[model samples]
Target chain A: MRRLTDVGALREAYDLVIVGAGPAGMAAAVEAAGQDRAVLVLDENPGPGGQIYRAIGTAPLRDPRVLGAAYWEGAALADAFAAAEVDYLPGATVWHLDDALEIGVSAGARSAVLPARRVILATGALERPMPLRGWTLPGVMSVGAGQALLKAQGIAPTGRVVLAGCGPLLWLYAAQCIAAGAAPSLILETTPRANWRGALRHLPAFLATPYARKGLALMARVRRHLRVVPHVAALAIDAEDGALRVTWAEGTAFTADHVLLHQGVVPTLNLARAAGCAIAWDEGNACFAPVTDAWGTASLPGIAVAGDGAGIAGAEAAALRGRLTALEALRALGVLDEAGRDARAAPHRAALARWSRGRAFLDALYRPAPHFCAAPPDAMACRCEEVTGAALRDAARMGATGPNQLKAFLRCGMGPCQGRMCGPTITETIAQERGIHPREVGYMRLRTPAKPITLGEFAALRKTEADRRAVERR
Target chain B: MFRRLPEPPARRIGFSLDGVAVQGAEGDTVAAALLALGRTACRETAVSGAPRGPYCMMGVCFDCLVVIDGLGNRQGCLVPLREGMVVETQHGRRDAAR
Candidate 1:
C-alpha cells in the first residue's frame, strides 16, 4: 500500500487520509495502520520528509552533520512509514477538502477526488513572512529557504552572505551553514532586548529541557565564526547597483550577495482554514492556528489537525501529537475503545509534555518585532499581488476593515499564493491601522483548491453527472 | 546566488533555461539548479514585472514560478529538473499559448 505511483492509482476512499508526510503525518499513519485501518498519506514534496527534514531520504549531502543530528532522525520515521501498511503518495498535492470528507488531489498533471472516513492535517509550518523593502529582490530569501537549499540539494550561499532576524532557528541554520563551509559573514538579530525580562520567568522550566543546552551550544558555535548583531531596531533590504544592500541599526548597511531572513515559523493554515476549521490567534506564538482539542479534533466532526498545523510545537511534539490524534480517531471509528485509546496515549502524552517543555520561553523570547510584523507603508505587504502596506492601510481607512473586504478593494490576498504569504501580515497591518487586535481583524477567507492547480488539472477531475449538469449551459 | 558543496556525486542532468542549455545535478529542483547555475532572478512578477527569485524554496511562495515544457506558472522550487526539459523565465502573466 506504500508509494502510490500516480493520482490515477488511488482508491476511491479510505478509512483515513492524512495530508502531509512530515513527522506528524508519518507517525499518525504508522499508529493507525498498525491497528489494521485503511490509511493513506499525501505529501506535496518530492519525498516523505517535509520542510523540517527536507530530503531526509534522498538528501544529496552525504555527511549527516551538514543538516544536524535532529534532521537525520527523520530517517527512522521515514523508514517506519515505509514499513507501515499505509498508502504513501509523494508529489501529490491535495488542493481541496470539504466537510463531507472528500479530498481533491493533483498529481503528475492530473487530478482525483477521494473520500475518507477521517482526515488528519499535518500540513506543518511555513516561515513567517518578513515584508521588508526589497524582500522580493533576487538575492533575498528566508533562512528556512536557505536551509532547505542546503539540505535538499547540497547547495550553500555563495559570496558575502548575511543572516538576519530572530529565533533559535536562525542560529541553528547559521551553525549548519558554518558546518557546510559557507559561514555567513554577519547576523542581524531582531529579538527585542526587553524580551529577556519576559522570557526569564520561564527559565527554570527551560533549563530542564534539551533545547536550552542545544540552543546555547549552537549559538556559541555560530558566534565564533560570524559577526552577531543583537537588538536590531530596524531592517531593510534594497537592490543597489546590482547587489543587495541590507540596512539596520541607524543607517549602518552592508552590501551582500545574499540576504537570508527569518523571524520564526508559523503553522501552515490555508488547508485547515479553507476546510472550515475555526482558527484563533495564538498570542504566545504571534500567529493564527486551527482550534483543536487535546486529541487534535477541529470544529468539524471528521477532521483532525495534528503537528504544527494545530499549533507551533516542534517536530518531537508533533510526532507525539500525531500518535495521540490517531488514537482519538481510532476510538471514534470503533477500532479502539475509549479505555484502549487512553491507555495507548498515556506514554505519548507524557513524552509530548516533556518535548513541549519551555516552549513558552522560546515563544516569548523569539516573538517577532512588531515593526517587522506590520512593516512600514512603503514595504511590500503582498508579494504575489504587489500590494504595499500603505495600500492595505488606505483600504482599511476607507472602510475595508476585514481581510475579505480588503481582497475586494485591493486584491491583497487574491494572488496565486492565496493569502498564505500575506495573510498574517495583512491581518496585522489592518489591525495596526484600525487600532484593534489581530483576532478582531481576523484572517483572509479562504476557499478550496487551496494551492493553485492549472485549469488542465481541474479538467482531469472525475466529475459526476450532477456536477456536469450544475455547470452545463442550457 | 549559491554554490555547490564539494561532495554528493550527483549525476548531471541537462535542461534549457530560457532556451539556453544548462546542466545541473540529478537531484536538484529547478530552482536549485537555477541558483546553482548562478542565475539569480527567475521570473518577473505578474503584477508589476519586478524581477524575483526563489524566496521560500518551499512551495509556499510563488516568486519562483517558471514555465516548464509549455506549462506556465509551474513552481520551480517544487518540480525536479529533468534531462532536456524546457525551462523558461516566466515573464508577467503566463502566455496562454506555449
Candidate 2:
C-alpha cells in the first residue's frame, strides 16, 4: 500500500474508490486489491481504523488488555490492508460523492475531483445525539469521545467522573476507564425498565450469540467496580461551582468533573444521502440507513453502502459486509462472474449470519428512551446553530413541514456540522409534533461540499465551463 | 478535565495555547493535547458565545473549532499537534481578513 500525501498525488481515476478507512474500508481494499483492481482509499483520520478500531496501529497504550481483545483484533486487518496493493491517503476527506462516481476530495489544503468505476461507502456510524439539558457544555462530551481520547492519546478524565445513558458502549468505556485508573464516580443507566419485556422475545438468540457472555461479563465487572443507578427515567446536567452537576430521578445528582454520555450509534448518512441513494427509516435501529440489497448494493449502480453506514452492525459484521461488497464490485466490474462471487462470499455470509444473531435483542434492549431521542422544548437540539427543540416545534407548527423547510424557517440543519448533530432529533421532533412517523418527516437534503472547504482549495481545483459559467459575472 | 496516564514517555512538542506555551506529546491531536492540559472550552460558539469544547474527537461535531497558526475555524481534533504551533481560542465567527 502506498500512502498518497496530497491531492496532486492521486491518480485521475481508479477502478474502485472506498471512502472511510475503518474495518469495512480496509477489508474491502484487501479483497479488491487481491483481485488486481486499482483501488484508492480516502480517510479523514491521520491513520486507519475508523472509529471502532481507531488508532489501532498507533495506540499509545502499551498493555493490550487495556483496550481488550475486540480492539486488538483490528491490527490483523490493518496489517492485511497494509500489505495489499492499494493507494491509501490519510487526512483526506471526501466532501462530495455523486451517482456518476465523481468524488471531490481535499487533502493538505487542496481539493481534487476523481472519477471511479465503483464506490463503496464504509463511512461508519456516529454516536446518537442525546440532547438533554446542558449537553453542549464544555466538560460534557460523548462517551465515544472519552474512549477516543484514551485509545489515541492514553488520557482519561482525572477528577470525579460520571458515565450516563444506555447501550453496551457505555459499559465498555467504563471498563476501559477503570483499566486506565480513571474509574468513573457513577454510572446512571437510562435503559427503560419496560424495554426488558420488549427484548425478552429475542433472548434465546442473545444467549446463543457470543456477545451475550462477553456483554454480561463486562456489565458485571462495571457494576462491581462502580456506583450504579438503574432504571433512571430522567437526567440533566448543569454547571455549578465551576463543575458539572448531573441530575436525575427525584433531584438526585452527582457533582462531577466530567460527564460522558452515550446511548447508541447510528449510521452516518450524509455522504450516502448526498450520493442520492434511496434511504428508509429503520424502525429497529431508529435511524435512517441507506437502502441496500444483500450484497450491499445500493439503489444506484456502481455505488455500494457497506459496514454500519448501511446499518448499525458491529465491527466484525462490517468487515464481512465489506468483503461481500467487494465481491459485488468485482462482479460488476467484470473481474469475477456471479457464481465465482457467490462462491467466494459463502464463508463471509455464514459468519455475518452468526455475528448478527443477537442484534435485535440489543436493539430492543438499548433503544434510547423517547425523551432522550426527542429533545424536550427547553433543551437545545442543534448545538452548532443553538436551535432549541421549542424553536423546531414552533417552526413545525408554523408551516414548516419537513427538515428542509425547517432549515429555511429556522436554520436548524444549516450549521458547520451540517445537521449531523441535529438531523435525527429534528426528524423525530417534527414527527411527534405533527403526529406522523419520522419517515414522513424525512432527513435534510444534503448537497455537495458536504464538509467545510476553504475558498482557496476551491479555487485551486481545475475548472470546467459549467463552473466558469456559473461563477462568471454576465 | 482530563489527565494523561503514566506511559512510556514520547517526545514532547511545545506549542502555545492563546500565547501560553504548553507541552504535548508527539502524535497527539490538538484537542487531546488541550484536554490533557485541562484546558477545556477551546472556543465559544459562533451562535451564542457559550463555552464549548471538543464533543466528538472523531470530527463529527464542530464544537472543537479553534484557530491554529492564524487559520480560523479549524477543527482541533482533526489537526495534529505540531511543534511551535500557535493555537488560539476562536471568539465568535471567523475573521473575514483571516
Candidate 3:
C-alpha cells in the first residue's frame, strides 16, 4: 500500500476513492483492492480504524479485556488493510466533495484534488449535541472524548469524574474505567424509556439475534461498583468551588473534577449533503441520515455512503455493508457481471440482516434524552457560537421555518463544528416549538471546506503553473 | 494526572508550552500534553474572555484551538505533540490574533 501526501502525487483519477479509513472505508478498500480496482482511502486520523476501532494500528492494548473483545477484533481488520493493495492517505482532510466525485483534500501544508469515477463516503458519526446547564464550563466533556483519550494514549480521569447521559459507548467506557481499576464518581444515565408497546413487534427479531449482548454485558460489569442513577430528566453542570457540580431533575447533585456528557451519535452528513444526496430523517435513531440503499448507493448514481455516515448500524454491520458496496461498485464498473456480484453479495446481505435486526431495538431503546425534543429555554444549543435554545425558539417565532433560516437569523450552524454539535439540538427545539415533525423542519445545509483550511493551504492547491494561471484568470 | 498502566510513559517527548519546557509522552497530542500538565484553560473567549479548555478531545469542538509552532488556529487534539514543538494559547481568531 502506498501513502500519498503531496498533491502532485495523486493520480489524475482513481477507479474508486473512499473517504474515511474507518471500518466501512477500510473494509471497502480491502474488498476493492482484492478485486484489482485502483483504490484510495483517505482519513483525517493517523490510523485506519475509525472511532470504534481507534488506535488499532499502534495499540497492541496490553489487555484486550480492558477495551473489550469486540474492540480487539479490529486488529485483524487493520492487519488485512495493511496487507491490502489500496493507497492510504493518512492525516489528509477531505474538506470539499462535489457531485462529480471530485474531492478537495488538505494534508499538512499541501492540498490535492482527487477525481474519482465513484466515491464511497464512510464518513462515520459524531456525538449528538448534549446541551445542558453550565456545559460550557471548563471541566465538561463528551464521553467519546474520554474514550478517545483512553484509546489514543490510555489516558483516564485520575480524579473524580462524573459520566452522564446515555448510550452503549457510555457504558462501554464505564466498563473500561472499571477494568482499568478506576471508577467514576457517579453515572447519571438519561436512559430513554423502553417503548415496550411499540417494541413488542420487533421482539421476535431481537430474540433470534445476538445483538446488544455486548452492551448488556458491559452494563452488567459497570453496575457492580459504580453508583448508577437511571433516567435523569433535568440535567445541569455548574462550576462550583473549582469543580463541576452536576445537578439532575430530582435535585441529586455531585461535584467532580470532570463531567463527561453524551446523548448518542448522529451521522456525519457534510460530505453526503454537499454531494447532493437526498437525506431523510431516520425515525429509529432520531437523527438525519443520507437515504442510502442496501448496496450503499445514495440518491446519486456515482456516489455511495456506508457505515455510520449512511446510518447508525454499529461496526459489524458496517463491514458487511462495505463489502456489499465494493461488490456493487465492481458490478457497476463492468468488472463483475450481474450474476457474479449477486453471488458475492448474498452472504454479506444475510449477515447484515441478522446484525440489523438488533439495530432498531437499540435505536429505539437509546433514543436521545427526552429533554432534547424541547430543551430548557436557556440551554446552550450551539457550542461554537454559544447560541441558546431560547434564541432558536425566538427565531422559530419570527417565522424561521427550518435550520437554514435559523442559520440566517441567529448564526446557529455557521461555526467551526459546521453544525455537527448544534444541528440536532436546534432541529429538535425548532420542531418542538413549531409543533411540526423534525423531518419537516430539516437540518442545516452543509457546504464545502467542511473542516477549516488555512489560506496558505488553499494557495498550495495550485500544484502547477497552469493551475496558477487558471486561478489568476478566475 | 492520567497515566497508562504497566508502562511508565514509555519515553518522554519534550515540548514547549508558551516558552516553558513541558514533558509529554510519545503518544500524547498537544491537548493531552497540556492536560497531563494540569493546564486546563487552552484559551479565552474572544467575546467574553472567559477561559475554556479542551472539552471534546475529538476534533469536533473547536474549543481546543492553539498556536502550534507559529501556525495559529490549529486544533490541539488533532496535532500530535513532538519534541521541541512550540505551542501557545490562541487569543482569538487567527487573523485578529496576528
lDDT per model vs. reference: 0.90, 0.91, 0.81
**DockQ, every prediction:** 0.86, 0.87, 0.64
- lDDT winner between candidates 1 and 3: 1
Chain B TM-score for candidate 2: 0.92
Q: Indicate the worst ten consecutive residues by lDDT in candidate 1 chain A.
A: A1-10
Clashing pairs in 2: none
Model 3 C-alpha lDDT per residue in residues A1-474, reported as the tens digit of each score? 787765567777788988888889988888888666788888888777888888886653467778878888888888888998988888788888888788898777688787888889998898887888787777787889888887878778878888988877888889888887767878988875554556667666666666446566678878988899887777888888888788886667887898888878888988888778899999888888999887899999888898888988889988888888888888887789989999988988998887788666666667776575455677778877778888888889999978898899888888887887787888888888988888888888998888889887887564777766876855
Model 3: lDDT of residue A135: 79
Candidate 3: lDDT of A413?
83
lDDT of 1 by residue, B1-98 (tens): 68889994799998889889889998899999999999888898987878899999989999889989988889999898899999999988654333
- Model 3: residues >4 Å from true position, as ranges? A194-196, A211-213, A373-375, A463-474, B93-98
Chain A TM per candidate, in order of listing: 0.98, 0.98, 0.95
